[model samples]
Target: MLGAIYLSQEINPHNVMVNQETKVEQEGQHFFLRSKKDFDLYPTEIRIQLGGCEYFILLNGRIDDREHLFQKLSLDANKSVSDTYLIGMLYQKFDLEFVNFLDGDFAFSIWDKQKNRLILAKDPIGIKNLFYSVDSGSVIWSSAIRNILHIVPNQKVNSAYIKSFLLDHPIANESTAYENIYRLESGEFLVCENGHIKKDYYYQFKIPSITYRKEEDYFQHFNQLFERSVHNRLRTPDNRVSIPLSGGVDSSSIIAMAENINKKDNWKYNIATYSIVFDEKEADERKYIKSMLEKYNLKSTVVYGDEDWNFKIDFNVLKELDEPYPLFNRALASKTLSAAKRDNISVVLTGHGGDHILHADLNYLGELLKKGKIINYIKDLKQWKNKYPLHQILKQNTLDPIFRKTRLEYPSWLKKERFADMDLSTILTKRFEELKWDSKTITAYFNTIIRQTGHEWFDQYLSNPIGVERRYPFLDVKLMEFLAAVPPTLKIRPANNKYIIRESLKAYLPIEIYGRTTKGNHSFLITKGFKEEWNRITEYYDFKILTELGFVNGEEIKEYCERWYMGYRYDLYNASGIMRALALEIWLSDKQDII
Candidate 1:
């Protein structure tokens, strides 16, 4: 949650410390430091010896000059606080033995003067932002890519990354929108010494052995673990919390559990919930949300959407995101987080990882069925074949590459003839080559982070103005291990995705949500809104810049935009590509003088 910049210069140690400290304090986090050696006879070291040589630099987010607990602990020598603090404190205590013990959303760097080395690490989930680059003779770290730009002037756009980002939304792991700048992936650490960088993984997710002997046993264990995860997040003395309630199973389950805890403790804690409602009926789910609120007696607020928020376009919302991200239903979460900041809420709980991990999409079950699980396959086919309508199930086999190729062919509305000179394969192949990583490694990296840490990258990067702290009980390490232990068949049986989770929460959640067949489909909503805006914007952009830039074929780009608005969903791929290209053009135009 804090931004830090560290530099060691042989030319001037004092000047370097002063400059770094000033920058750190300007970032508005507490700033303190201890020298490697004492200069004055009275001891320049700000040392409080707790039977250890580890020097502490404490920063208070909420208070100033509060009673120092470490001082008190030094006096008592045996008193105990929560294990969470102990985990963080021990890293500072046994500096050599345990240089990296961290939890929660944090990024820290440990510098060992004795060995003339430095180690940098991010939270397992990457809820905190950290970026680094080494050039000439110095290593630089910063919380924002812009901050790094302040010190390193030669930064340039990585054109290959730009192509991949245009094809996909968020740049994949370790790749930044900028070329030379690189992000430390989630659950990873970097050790730098003697001008060499070594990267290593500190955490990995593993499937656990199933121990539940009966249905009730599974239910009991799940309930206990679920409650513990919720309780851990609610440890703050003040029980006021916020949940982004969409009337979905994930958010509803969290709200219900938190309310239950408040009731049990005889606490009059306020649960502030927020939801977004679009003007269009197909996009709005406010009616269902109202039902859930009435059932739970929860106080809630709604932020009505305005189609005419001109600032949405002016802000260049896509460029502001930490990575290239898919539209994510047109950035509703960004708007929600903006409102939450206005309300002065610090921590918000979300139901993000539940669907991905526990209630994987029903298609996963169909894949299992295709791999030949007889009864499960038959049941899934009968229940979802009509609803989801998988082509693989209809053919009783996986789709051939030829069929996939046909599906990938550009539509006629896109004007393939106009774009015939553009070599898309060359672009894609160049992106793959630039990544310098195999598809399997990329897939494994994503899977490990999601399973272990949930979608921390989204929570960390998306929340702006000031960052929003987010808690994901579904991605709690204990919960993931438990879910992984359950057989995949039992987890997604009888055409019910997240079968085990649904059954466990049956008593607590509304029956309507549990029995719901369709997930909340927001593509139509986003497509409708984007089509209109894209049309209006492209008219100004196509003539004003696209033709002049020469990187994009302006007429072809216009056709692509029209095809998208004319109700071609696949055309979004092309539309997104143009959007990214336009964004880059704007960025370069603005920074043209700087270059």
Candidate 2:
């Protein structure tokens, strides 16, 4: 498990030493390697030094046809036994385009001494993450930002990034919280040489709707793709797998599919389903979880989702990921990763990207307008109005195109006048703005989830702490491509969202599970956690660091928190606002050295 790669133009003592503890291994000139020790991972670390070029591949998950591809490459090129097929194939191609054929999560870098060029790439769906920072003619990259900061300790925090975090979530695409450092977006590859840096994206999600006609054909196609994704994810020699089941259709459907996978293939892998239990009955889904466990006779592990958990206040522990993330969901995810590691489960499958991928937004109407399907748009608008009032529907569906070009959302946030420099040019890269204007409705929706939410890096960071890999079957490139192409009629029609998934998995999934129309309300859980954690949070509530750095107004934030806990005005959004502030204060406090 080569966890990260640090590259420099000329290695210095500070850059060579990765951390205080682990001794760094030299891979080539100006390249140092580090990996998580003593963990069983598949497609084990591949490193080759070939003909003035050095190639390295690290895996947290297995490639679909790793063995088959290796054999094919070896035979096709007549490569020697000592040679690595992955490197050989890339060298034979003499270009980075061959990375598009990879089918699993990976981060690889090729250093060509003769050509004086280096390329770093990640998987197409961004199941993997690669962060790079260019400083003093050196390209420093690692899977984690904390590692990069260890070398370039003088880097300053980007104030624009913090303001953007307050307005929305993390900065989309490549920009990090620190200047001169950037992460590669999904399907993006970086090329550096001759004092010039270039980045390019290899994959763009395009829905191939016209290719399939029958609804049943789409269902069968979806079933096949999902089964393959599940199967590919489970290709471990350990004969064990972990699934975080929530008793909802997404996770439950994965359970049903995994059951069918073992039965059809005659495999006997032990499947473990981990679920979170709460003190309150409403927050629990015992009834639904029980049925799936009994139906498949699977092993179960339960972690108490305590309402009084104050881990969010413990900045000492929260700094593990070094991201100002709202920690509500991390409660379950952290426990699941730990359970997987304890059980020797190298791979954990979750239903994270399911909602975004399976559920189509109402914005498809905007796309209809672009296509000049005015009659169809009106008909759909009436159905939408039946569910929601005309105002909400029209504002969301009809006004998208006008707002897309005429104005962006930044002006609204800037009106608050809470941040410095009203301009967003420093915060967002030009590529992100281009993506916003160029994308259609379908691409827009996917981009919001994959990039805007920081799903790739956040998911990668969560698992890295425990040395386990996270896979979202819904984010599987094949499944998403098909889902992207299918018409809105298949996605949502006659007031049914995710119509394709519900219909396709109808026979396999429990009717009660697939029939669920509303999502589980965690407001009660959040409210409970909020009340308990607030008491402990205020004990050490200090925003001196943020206010001193001009990231926030200290007095205003404290007043906001006081009003929230005193019941002046509070809801889910307010609670989230207080938590983000708390997270930011804690985050900035930890970075006092740099700030």
Candidate 3:
């Protein structure tokens, strides 16, 4: 929760006026920082002068390797230490290159007065957020988009961003919902100095070119990295922490690992678990959840999906997020966060990002075919066909990427003319060609780094108001790097995904989770909520703003909804499209009024 404005020497600093408390109002300076005094966060707003260079740092999250960073940088351990100072020392030693050695969930900005340079960087995995808008050689940035809006009140909506959001298509990684405002993406940094601005990635996905001697070596290394990731995130003020435990392998395995570390280190703390259970048998995981709770001897607070099935619009939430969020799981996520807050929990670990990095798909099959490894491709495809139909395997791994047919289904309700000028098909096709890695690795990398960053930031934004910080052990940079290098065969067997985890944590996890094949589906909750609220939801079916803007056909949307309400079950993509449309319509009308 930090916001600031930095002006290059060419711009007038005196023209700026920020409506924030705890202001840094220094005379004859070109920058001012104002941080929200919530969450009792550490290392608040450090300003220091070293070697004729004045520096200002604003950090939203904690640094895990503070002691190591201090010792390596030759800073006195006994001296008063703060995360901000440690970062400043890193900058002193390595300049902007200091980002490589950092580890934690953080989004920070550093200002160098002597060089008139400003740098903004987010953590490698994007657990935190930093959004900025540049105009006339000046920059405005904040941890929250609403805060940035507060300063630039008359910002225009980005129609391109809206189109991509509604259509569920890929857009520029830096694009935000606002025209000028842009998000500094995960693993990236932006620098502005001397009336010039440049953005570049400090980190990129790389696979190590080494071979392991044995299969057990891979499992052992994965467990070590996984344990270190869990250990680092357990740094809280009190020894109390909580987890959003689903009965799936990811969450269950985290609970198992945490317990292992707890007993091994003899560091006992109160661990709370919160879960969203469903009445629908297909979506229910209470049986497995109970096993995890009983086995780990941990208690879980439950939030039932059937009990909290209202999809009402909250203007406050919309205002806070300042984006079009998926409507399907919002209520469930909010309820779980509320339950955690009610129990006085501030940090909640989650199993998000596991599927992207851990589960392997058939993308490598297409790669093998193209590389002339026909025998290997046939063998793998035959194995996969045992679990799925041949047509599906071929379409997903080969035909889809080549023909660009697996992108978002263009619902018949939308205006086709609006999309004609965008050349979305070419963009989608080019997306695959731009990355030269194996198909499996490329898909995993994009999902984990590019796509998931937005989701991670949204989760962070959603939990901010409730005073909860969500940490993801699966999203750790080191762990992801190691997993990236792992061969696709190790991750995806004939009948199993996440083969590495299933093999590595067999002893630690319960039999139910380790050997489980099916994962919980949220489509049940989506359908249930929509059915119960059809009448209320259809009130906005008019879509006056959207229809008037030539994005959708009102009558067509109504027909689609009526069909669903009358007993037709649309596929997951089509059903989710309706929810996405509703969310966008609300934001289009409400956000304009709010801002």
RMSD of each: 8.1, 4.9, 3.7
lDDT of 2 at 51: 61
Judged by lDDT, which candidate is best? Answer: 3
Per-residue lDDT for 378 in model 2? 90
Q: What's model 3's lDDT at 22?
A: 35
Lowest lDDT block of 10, candidate 3: 426-435
Top model by TM-score, which number? 3
Put down candidate 2 lDDT per residue, 251-327, tens digits, no spaces: 99887888899888786777788887676666677777787787777767987765434344355555555556656
In order of appearance, the predictions have TM-scores of: 0.73, 0.83, 0.88
User: Among all windows of ten consecutive residues in candidate 1, which has the lowest summed lDDT?
Assistant: 36-45
Tens-place lDDT per residue, model 1, 298-357, is 767787664522213543554455444443333455666666667877567788777655
> Which lDDT values do the candidates have, in the order given?
0.53, 0.64, 0.73
TM-score of the candidate numbered 2? 0.83
